[model samples]
Target: MEQRHPEKRNDRNTDLTSDQNLKDRPERQESDKAEQDPGERNAIDSNPGERKPAEPNAGERGSRERNRGERQPTERTSGERQSVERASGERNPGERNPGERNPGERNSGNRQGNDRNQRDKDRNEGVADRHEPVDRVAPDRMAGEIAREGRRSADNGSSERQDRSAGERGPADRGTADRGTADRGTADRLVVGITLGDYNGIGPEVILKALQHNRMQRICTPVIYGSMRILNRYRNILNLKDWNLNGIQNISQASHKLTNVITCWNDQNHEIQPGKVTTEAGQAAFACLQRAVEDLKAGKLDALITAPINKQNIQSEEFTFPGHTEYLAHEFGVQDNLMFMVSETLRVGVVTGHIPLGRVRSSVTRERIVEKLNLMYQSLKLDFGIQKPKIALLGLNPHAGEEGLLGQEENEIIKPLIKDLREQGRLVYGPYPADGFFGTRSYRDFDGVLAMYHDQGLIPFKAIAFDEGVNFTAGLPIVRTSPDHGTAYDIAGKNQADETSMIQALYMACDVARRRKEHQDLEANALNPKQVVEK
Candidate 1:
């Protein structure tokens, strides 16, 4: 866990100008006199008539006498000497000194000084009370300590309260405390498999950047399915020479403390032509994906986060699918799956994905839409922990077919399906114009949106959340997610690719995997209400 630093407060110079400080420390007054402008001091001595004829208190008189002893006395007439003695309270005061401040002014100045000193003292004490040790500590322990201190400061609370609060809320709040409990829990963190996408592209760059976070290891152990040599090439290019990865040939040798890399290939002299599409790069990408998927399917891994891959170059005799989603769907033997785009605020799943724009019209069937909807619904409940999810469907044509005049798909196909689903008690609505839906930001009204085609959903989703979106295959039995981007041949190896989407994909994969396990546990442990009542 990343540690937080407490802000340091500078309070050593407090109360320097307070009246008590000036009276008790004559040296401070002497320093003030020494710091005064020499011309101003000379002017005061040269024109005694301009000096304030204030009657000095005994303390002030003693300070002045000591300061005056360091310099020659100014020549004055006998009358002026008597007046000065009278101002110094040596004689009866028949008349008040002209330069003496009134009692109200003295009292106000003293009050202002005292108020400022009190405020500074209070601020310093508050900072001291809130200050934590600067050294590194576990985040959960730190959070607990902070909470305890806060409660104690709130009302002289007992240690019992602190202990109880920490016990009740510490794990839930920090998430670090709960990593030690059960299977894939505390004893062993969830091992997430990350397949390095096209080596020539920005995959290794982003993977390295995302894994550099300190919190990544605390939550789960990451195993990179690629050659360490390839990773080192990009690591050197990115100038992350200081960053290290634990290289191992198999998962058995993976380390929990460091990022583990499995050498999927043995080739050391493979040419790495970055920013260019090459068959070798595609083959290498496929090799990494195949190895990672094998581990994932064999239950050796908890989740899989695939980096961006080039759809065209990755095609081979063994891998003929258009993209990772289709390939994973086939590998897992799922006949149909939803290509879902996920972000913090919006979720969109296309009814027809990776198909030509011409084929999209024919693919917009009621069954396909219903299939994607069910997948999205289950994903929301089991993977996202949402109890009831509302879904919106985008129209195939302009103005939602304008009452069947512009197009018949929305009126003949989409509207009927939505009506049937609503009758079946599903929170489904739409056949809405895609333009107006996103233009008016109506997607915010629903939990998810079902687009009729690829661009209908992605064009807007990417525009809104390009940096943080994750493309998740919704119906897969195993968790699979990837950054919502492709191999940017233009910017590959430039070290300018943003890693936000990759990090988000990793986070979503782990979160969904954990949620699925929790859901399965709940289903397995579900109690029979009637049997319980009889007992």
Candidate 2:
């Protein structure tokens, strides 16, 4: 009996030198038995000196393992054992498994199956994980997966668990949450109310036309207070079949994405004679105005834009006031309000609004002029974002009363008011003659013009900006604007009327509302001058 090298046992014709080696080294014998296949082990034990079958090469053994779908025990080095373990789906602790693909590897069908299985597991756990890095997931797919997971949790009645999961979400999920918050915030555009004035006139026509612009929908949510039946008729008459309105019963149901119409009257049988000023039209107009004003007062509306309404036709027991401006002032409990006419180039306010020519002389007092000027000044600063407003005062008489020759109202009342105002550190100029002031385009030199009467201011305003003028009521607690025109019975249903004024009025209302909010914010957060001095 003799010792033999273990490496020499793999030779095709080698024989064990002796059985004494196996007896002497029991541990080596057991190791060899464990490492060798059963057939080889049996052959070696049967006859120690017998020649064993030639050992298969590494490639052949691997091919045989694949064909048999099982691993065959064979003597191998440490590195070779690791390779075999990896091929057999076994690994050391913390070592990556064979199923995991490297970055450069092509995605095979098996990898896809593994990914799907992982996703299914995540869903069962009520988690929205892709088992991949956040950057590797497409943004849209990530959002969709999160939404699906949320819905699944809701379906399972696991709202509490859903909330907990949201709290535990990573940065990508938090980003999605922030985007959702921003989408909701974007729906907070100014809610503007448009009152369909004098339905028998051009009110409905211009309203439909104004709302057709896509920009209107982007800037504000328009709620029309009128009869939807009449609006639809006008829409069809104007050949605007493509336009649509979301009809809701109440202002709360108004949609931010569509132009909403709230039906104020249910007079389905009422005939809409576009050019006629009938009692029914007046009553219907009042109904719409009343409902709109109710909502305006309740703070549901951010701003209001009224279309043209016939003054004589709209007058009733319920609406006894002269016009929208006066009615809004009385409703808001304000004694003094100015009729502020606004355009891109000129801004005018009347000292004596809706008064007769004879009363204009009486109403053009020093106190009244000062009140209107103060209102215009404040409106310019707050609504128009003008800090130091320069205003021009139009005279009550011709040539500013020619120094008391033509009329003494201007020389006595208006001149004295202007001088006193200038003394008090206010930018108040002239008692300029109304005719020459506008004829020379002097209105452009000032921030606002104070007229002695309504027609005096509005006549020139409409003449200059007939298509774009906005009539804003100054000194009120709320923002209100309207087209600087009346209900045009001449072109009521013809569809020939211009909608520019109505569009500009709506724009001005939203602009003024935003400016007022900004002003209020600045006032609220303003630093105290006295505190600064003390510091």
Candidate 3:
């Protein structure tokens, strides 16, 4: 061979083209059929030390592969360019160099990331951001979705005045909310579940009286869960019972004559003789309460208003439950409960309810009193429709123990609880010797009282508002209102059982229902989206 200079070996093909071709090669068909092929290109570019062979069609190998490679970017669609930047780790078209970014593309990603971070910050702060975290949606928020803003602290004085506009505007805004809830009732009157207390008592009479009015029909479709036999007796006594009782067995089980109807469930025709006190009557009364509780649980009844029951009667037949208050609490699985008397002037809640005086000392703790006071306050506002109800807290000791000289309970127990309640914005005042406070008609000013003992609140309560007071179970899941009196056995047969307490109970039920209807409407709207289309 003629002597060739080393400089000539670096030809046009070996210089730029060879290095550039190194970027893409191999995967050639010439490599596969080695018998018929010579240029057997390898797919994997070997390390500099060793070059692997027969990598056919690898690394952009073609007649004009380099030209095609140069043309790839210009030929790519915008979406493909974006995808290449994403999947192939290619730089964005505008800035494919270090220490720089494509302004438009970079700005787009920056804006999205910033929006996501801002949404997260707003959620933690409870701000109403347009975009929210999926997990932080109120429905997905851990149970107990309390109002995040303007929360009423447990330590402020309640009488501290809010803006007059806030007070005035609440109802005006509520008008819209109430209109929302009315959708269900207007379509079909609200199904009101009424439970008769003691059939032998005045449970049957009150129902006949309360339902005879046309107003109840306009507001609710009243369903009484009791025996048809007793309802018949009530209708007969009122003469309108003879007129057109329009009474039925079940909601779906109505007769032709039972058209504008009184709804009765699971009708048992036990002979109901007025003034007759028997275990059968007791069992029937007990059954009625149980049935009403089941209906309330099943959501068939919008609200339940119970009549007076003889405590002795409900406690009979091994149902030996203390009374309706305890029995209903047990039935509905409610642990925290209190007996409240709701009247126009004042509300009274018994601390150690239905238990004897001896047990009062042990049961009436500062903690229990404080909790009861809080519940009472909330209940008065929510259930009784009281606005900023004032509360009078009584002392366990007579003359409030003359300041611990006579007894230590007033000083040791009541004072601390009152202070705690007062700190929580409750209008609570007393340890005022029970005698002087209630004796002077001072309770009249307050909306409610938390008596240290059951009899302490009830004695004065019943004495003044006997026939008018409505027995209420505060802090319960369901609505329960009844007459605060016992079955008047003395006047049971005389037709002289003054229906005053029963009437009060009916009115109380109506008032509570109306208010509940209003409040539920407010809460539902605040919780729902703007566009709600019912099916």
TM-score leader: 1
- Sliding window of 10 residues with minimal summed lDDT for model 3: 131-140
TM-scores, one per candidate: 0.68, 0.66, 0.60
Regions more than 4 Å wrong, model 3: 1-188, 213-215, 237-242, 252-269, 316-318, 527-535
Leading candidate by lDDT? 1
lDDT of 1: 0.73
Task: Report each candidate's C-alpha RMSD, comma-separated, in the order given.
Answer: 16.6, 20.2, 26.3
Q: Which runs in model 1 stand beyond 4 Å of their true positions?
A: 1-188, 528-535
Cα TM-score of candidate 3: 0.60
Q: Mark the regions of model 2 whose C-alpha exceeds 4 Å error after superposition.
A: 1-184, 527-535
Question: Candidate 2 lDDT, tens digit per residue, 1-535?
Answer: 2343333322311122122223435664564466569864455445434544675543343333322222324334333444555686765312434344321122233444665564455534422332112212122222224323423432323533343444356768666655654354345467889999998899998888877622254356789999888888887788876546788999889866568999998869887898998988888888888999999999999998888777887787778887888888888999998899898899989888887787777666778777888899999988887899999988877788898999877766877777888899999999899999999999889999988898888899989998889889999999999988889889989989898788778777877787777677779999988778742
TM-score leaderboard ranking: 1, 2, 3
Cα lDDT for residue 179, candidate 2: 60
Which candidate order results from sorting by lDDT in descending order? 1, 2, 3
Q: Residue by residue across 302-386, what tens digits does model 1's lDDT show? A: 9999988888898999999998988998899999999999998999999999988989888888888888899999999888878
Quote the positional error of residue 329 for candidate 1 in Å.
Answer: 0.9
Which one wins by lDDT: 2 or 3?
2
